[model samples]
Target chain A: MLAALPNPQGVSVCPRRARWQLDLLLLALECVDLHASELMLQVLRELQLQGMIPNRVVFWQIRCTNPFRQVTQRTPLPLAETKALTAVVVQVARRQTAILRHLLLVLDQLQAQNLPPETYAPLAAYLDRFRRNFRKRMNLQRSSLFLYKNHQALNELGLKLLAQLLLCAGTKGMERLWFSLFDGEVS
Target chain B: MLLQRQYSLPNCTLRIEGLSGQAGAEQLDIVTCCEWEIIGQNQRIKGGKDFLVALLNSVPAAAQTWLSGVKLRRSPQYPIQVEIAAANQVSLHIPRKLLQTSPEENSESPTNDEAGETLEVHLTWLQLADLVEALDQFCSDSQTLPTLIPTFHSLPRRAIAPAVPLRKQLMPLGIGAASLAAMAAIFFHFPVPERRPPREEALPPTPEAVTPAPAPTTPNPPNP
Candidate 1:
């Protein structure tokens, strides 16, 4: 049996790294589907976890904890909100497992053939959207974001993040993601 | 009376037989017999409630580590343990207590004297995926154990590998680079393969010297 998280309520603040990871995963989900926010809300309702996230406004508030965001929130994200977000992300990834697998397979084939990512329409679209989203939402002045100034760099980051999201869809994905959030923060 | 429920897939089948416990009208039946079978393989395990509980508990977390080895055990009293035997394979160890004895004591059969013996069933990942889907279906059934809802819990701190210092993490790379450099130095000292002159037959005809081949005519030429 796994150990319960220390705080069930929204008392304890989530670790900064966890917040960044969650936000990035959410970004990858958005790249996968344009209406990801709506899908997340629907999943939240389906999972009966609305009490923690409440609505879109509250969801946006929690997601703003990502330091790279252009309009970042100063307040630390709450553990409850983190759990809710993680749950939603995992559920979304689970639902998109087939598509995710297909995209990754295509990516592998492309890499094997030494073909550019744009050769495949769907994958090219996903990477292009990811780049645009990152550029629009992120504060480019931030050291990390500044490094991804070029389209190619941003595309590579997007592909890496997409693979990570796929991992989050695997079995025990929820717990795996939860533990990963606290990776270096614990010790 | 025993009630049997099974979830079947193209390659796998999970069957559970149990009696309705003192559960009220809305509650699920108590599981007693559980069997997992993967077709085209000599893999099968028969257990009871303990096995089901262990499976239900472990599965959600089992895939957490890239499907790394996971050992599922409820308690000592429940002598069944399920764990990953190899990459792409899952093994369930059913205790001898759960094993039935044949009327004729064959030498090949496990005898009562053989204590602490277990029958192990190995299943491929595809088979495991089917089993997990079946378990998920079982968990969703409102009539099943109402308290048996699948939930995710964070792994304990100790269970997670502690983050290594940057220096420690880089040490292996440094060692690898130094060894590679040493190997390269040794390789440079060795003699290279002697080059042989290309044979005339092996050489392709020069473009200028090459002549275009004549187009072959059909055996039955079309009337022109």
Candidate 2:
């Protein structure tokens, strides 16, 4: 009697469900690739080359600047670019979980290597500040960031990562200098 | 649609709208410049005092070099003024602590309400210029990052705590303890794993030969 029921094609049945599962799997893989320490290292190198020394209060001010309104109202980025900027802001807001993981990984690695506590203390303090400031931003669902159903959310994440990388470069530099000083003394 | 600009600080939000006549737009008017109206948070200071308090609190410690006299004007006649020089700092001007203490002791007094009214604030030269620039940037569409540098600075540091020497004091003691601990660990734990009976054929024949010798010696353990 069950055989009488037409056997649905394996590819055709619950296509939506299969697609959702694929998206989630892809997202998890993407998250795994987000090596925060490596990325931060690269960012620090770039900042040093550019001679950029980010002030502690700069990011805080940037955060306060209602990034959404600033991007929308002030920026002369084309409409597409504006949309992309919105998506990036949304992506940054969404990627908090992965960012937190990366921060923890950096801390764990520092401790594991028995690096001077001075090296990681500043970083840990900064990470705590970031967590406090962006905790609410992090809780947002990925869907809320999408303005239109058709807009692709691809490049926005990369942009957000770049912004954060630039933002934290100063703190990273200070930490690196302290670490080197302590490391030499220990040796 | 008239392009209005809104800038937000952590505690305060600034909104500016261009005041346009029938012929042409003149100057932008500040529609709102007030602290975030979060319920049950922040002392409920009325008038211009709220803005000054918000400005002072937002200032970074590193930027405190330029903080001078802060004068708050409610009217031309009576103004709450605080001189922030090398000696006096911004913390003295914060109305929160004053307001907090007043409610418990003098909640019923009308003078308490008058105190809030007395400290009406006015924007200094730098603050006004910053506001003007923000409004200009909002109206002019040039692709650039928002320049939201806050010139405000917190009160001068009362004292700078010296860095704690985390590893300095403990290093010598730790070196001695660590070496002894390592020797004790090697004596007690190091040889036990090699003494385990080899199960797999993958194990080298030398380990099998050594394993037999250790088994005999394990029974009279402490003598070794």
Candidate 3:
């Protein structure tokens, strides 16, 4: 007899591509706060969500699924882990809501004036940090990573991710992010 | 006795009036009235608790995909509807029934259809932010309903894809132009010196010419 399969709705596992997106979001969260790992633990503890994330080792394991990572993990991420990571992202984004709003407003002003993002000190620092973090962690040999070879391309990616994170911080952010993760995968 | 609490921001003010419920001081107050005003626009709307609940639930989803908008509506009793009108605007549609139609006016215009009439108020993003902030404050108050906590749902993927294409196309061009301009400015400020100039002995070297120009600032591209 064949082994029973897990019910899709009852034991929903995260899709393959969502792992990459989740890791990118986590990377963005780290750019926002250097101590993001510790903060994630704190949030899990505070929200009584320790059951989902368990501990730091498990957290790192889930993050290791990012395809760009130098040594990628082959295991699939479950939905619970996905929710835990998303909660952390949303919490961090919520805490920085004012700053995000300010940055976006500044971006609009710069765009209107035709000034580069580098003209603004805070935004420049963020984009630079994201680029540095991306370089230090990701495998540059990957074909997808090859497209981000130029400074301008990486910076634009950073800005786009930043804006997406802002949207994730807004109302119903958790739900919005949850559904978006499964966007194309679901029939 | 009726108690009133208000949260105010730069562009909006939210006011709530209620009385203590029979459940005692430990329980939430029985909300009697809820009101919101767009500060500079000189517009205000009044409703009961249902409207407040609808607003609290609608704002977050609306904030995410603003162009498509999320509507707040509660059946026959509370017909007021709120929708995101644009990137930075919100429109509230208040039914004419809630406006306290005057008896004299009703008599003078007997043929006027009340069902088709509504008073619409437009609010800028800043004003909407203020209202959201105010509602968040209200939600945090201990005297409010614990079960009615705000919840957000993401719109369908198809609805959001069409909203962002224009911004996506225009941003890169603007940034590219700005980057080129900055590069040109740097090049203009520092001139490279050529070797073996016969005119070097004829003119005194200025302070800037004597010193080497600083390295141009550029972000290091990721290694391939």
Q: For this target, which candidate reaches the highest TM-score against the unseen true structure? A: 3
Residue lDDT tens for model 3, B47-93: 67776665665554445444212222321133555665433346766
- For model 1, residues A33-78, the per-residue Cα lDDT tens digits are 8888789999999978777778899889889989889999889887
Error in Å for residue A151 of model 1: 13
Off by over 4 Å in 3: A1-8, A16-21, A34-61, A64-74, A94-98, A104-119, A128-187, B7-13, B20-32, B37-50, B63-137, B145-224
lDDT score, residue B40, model 1? 39
DockQ of each: 0.05, 0.02, 0.06
Give me the runs in candidate 1 sitting further than 4 Å from their true place: A1-6, A9-11, A37-64, A67-74, A87-187, B7-13, B22-30, B37-50, B64-133, B146-152, B165-224
What is the alpha-carbon lDDT of model 2 when measured against the actual structure? 0.30
User: A57-92 in candidate 3: lDDT tens per residue?
Assistant: 888888898877987888878766677777877787
Residue A49, candidate 2: C-alpha displacement in angstroms: 3.6
CAPRI band for model 3? incorrect
- DockQ-superior candidate, 1 or 2: 1
Ranking by lDDT: 1, 3, 2
Clashes of each: 1, 0, 2
TM-score for each predicted model, relative to the true structure? 0.49, 0.24, 0.51
**Top lDDT hit:** 1
How far is A124's C-alpha from truth in model 1 (Å)?
Answer: 6.4
- What are the chain B TM-scores of all models? 0.53, 0.23, 0.52
